[model samples]
Target: MSIITTATALLADIAVETDRTDAVQAFVKQETILVQITTADGLQGTGYAYTIGTGGTSVLSLLQEHLLPLLVGEDARNVEALWQRLFATTRATTTGAITSLALAAVDTAVWDLRCKRAGEPLWRLAGGHRREVPVYDTEGGWLHLGTDDLVKSALAAQQAGWAGVKIKVGKPHVFEDAERLRAVREAVGPSLHIMTDANQSQTISSALQLAAALEPYDPYWLEEPMPADDLSGHARLARSTRIPVAVGESMYSIMQFRNYLEAGAASIVQVDAARIGGITPWLKVAHMAESHNVMVCPHFLMELHVSLVAAVPNGKFVEYIPQLRAVTRSEMTVRDGVALAPDEPGIGIDWDMDAIDNRRVS
Candidate 1:
């Protein structure tokens, strides 16, 4: 067994392309916690997780001071056992963000190590259900964009062969949000899929109203209409709206997803691998969604999510929002609205060490 000889964690602050504002907060930068693990056999693996704007240092400290040391001298190949040990030892923070993020960093590194050792791409190693999954563009529809700009961007995405466009909701009034969706729908016509994300900004009543108002536009789904914790509210909205309910990005554990899925609160699962404590639990959620006859359309980290999505039979769409252009050498390939999973060994992210070193915060 190859023992974990060295483990390190660092924080890297990657800037967003523009000021991305939603109903809740403006995404200023991605505070990423990057982890590196080296085994006694000279094999190395890297993994990462992120915070939207703050607390990256806390995640890094959690890994360095509490989590990383646990892996030392442990069998690197025992990914599940190590993850369970970490999860149990960090039980104090079991249901929160910091612990999940820390676990993601370590768990993903272990997965990468396992895949590399087996000499298979992560998609194939995980479960090679398909090589290419459909893609949708979310960057073109930020809540701050003007109606004309939003229309133009949606049209451009459609012309570029994207599977669909996601528009941010939560304007000052329900009419304003409806008007924007109507305008985009009229421009893109009836065939193209249009998804709307409210970023967890509305009350249950407001979400019901907005969903009714936007129903005529034929949106594919209404995502995160209210705060993620409101399971009963989501169930009510899901029942009230004709549009499918999409959620799970804010959720941190398998049980959270189970609650949403079992309750029939969400039709589409937007499971973010990092936020759910890495690919280990990510696959668990995906399989669970599959068992429930639901679809998995993961949120963010498109570069990493593409492979995870393609690996599963129930994987539906990969959200297109590129973030690692500067820090990673590899980019996800999209052709005719479908994203091709990377065939390289391990997790498929080719990190630029110099860029990572330059941006390292801790």
Candidate 2:
């Protein structure tokens, strides 16, 4: 069957699980990108992007004014060829946030189509090597979460049988952030994995100081102590801190990941499925990281990532942020600390058509 006969885009807003506003980006109210593709046989695929806001509009503009014209009536099965065309089309900018986000929309749609055609879940289609992928709860369990809230969230995750929990550092004071981490460590104990993300919030010196202060608590990894693009800076921090530096949520290309890998910037790599040009390039990053003996702990889109991580031997933990529960048509099953990839064909997810119809922008 011919692929991608047509495509459409929309902007949507779904509430996050935590009323915890500080941990999320400031533009929380803005609707993000939602993309749907139709094939020649009338089969359709759907995907989305969760950029803070206005990302939906940027993706829509890029696709409609640029990529869609090229893709329409073209064989969607030619994912690699299409990727080359799209990437070449944007050669001036290459692959960055906007271009990759657009590619993510298309790449995800194509995979959805592939899954539907195969009548298997994305996980199975990606090679369902493992039924369960371990997860870590990320709900407002940070400095903003307060010591008590952090303890509550960590305890809840433990009680729910989660294998680990991620705490956010990067507050106004490094010592205060250390205290918050100490509280979480005390509550969860050492056996349970504990990770900390600085959200690109500190200077290298500050990150080093923070890492030292929190060193006693023993974090699983340190994420984005500086902006993700600061490769040299991250490498310096990696050298200084015992905590494995984890970056890549903000990175968009294999070249970017290569820079990090070559520089020894991060020990734990966190690839975002949507940010790195969809499943194709993400897998490349995973394989590359595997070769380097780096851990592949992907960022959000845990449902989609469950299959991806399970497919690779070097795959590590999947971030478990509980924001999509409200809007998704189906509930993702997460038992203990591990999540099971959706077994349904085509991304294993069906949009709440009624919700979509009601929320459709006129």
Put down candidate 2 lDDT per residue, 88-184, tens digits, no spaces: 8897766678888888877888788878888888776776677688888887474555688888888888887888888888777788888888888
What lDDT tens digits, residue by residue, belong to model 1 across residues 175-244?
Answer: 9999999999999999889999999999998999999999999999999999999999999999998899
What does the lDDT read for residue 250 in candidate 2? 90
Native-to-model Cα distance after best TM-score fit, residue 165 in candidate 2, in Å: 0.8
TM-score of 2: 0.94
- Judged by whole-model lDDT over C-alpha atoms, candidate 2 comes out at 0.79
Q: Which residue pairs of candidate 1 clash?
A: none
lDDT of 1 at 113: 96
| Superposition-based RMSD of candidate 2 using all C-alpha atoms, in angstroms | 1.8
Candidate 1's TM-score: 0.99
Worst lDDT window (10 residues) for model 1? 15-24
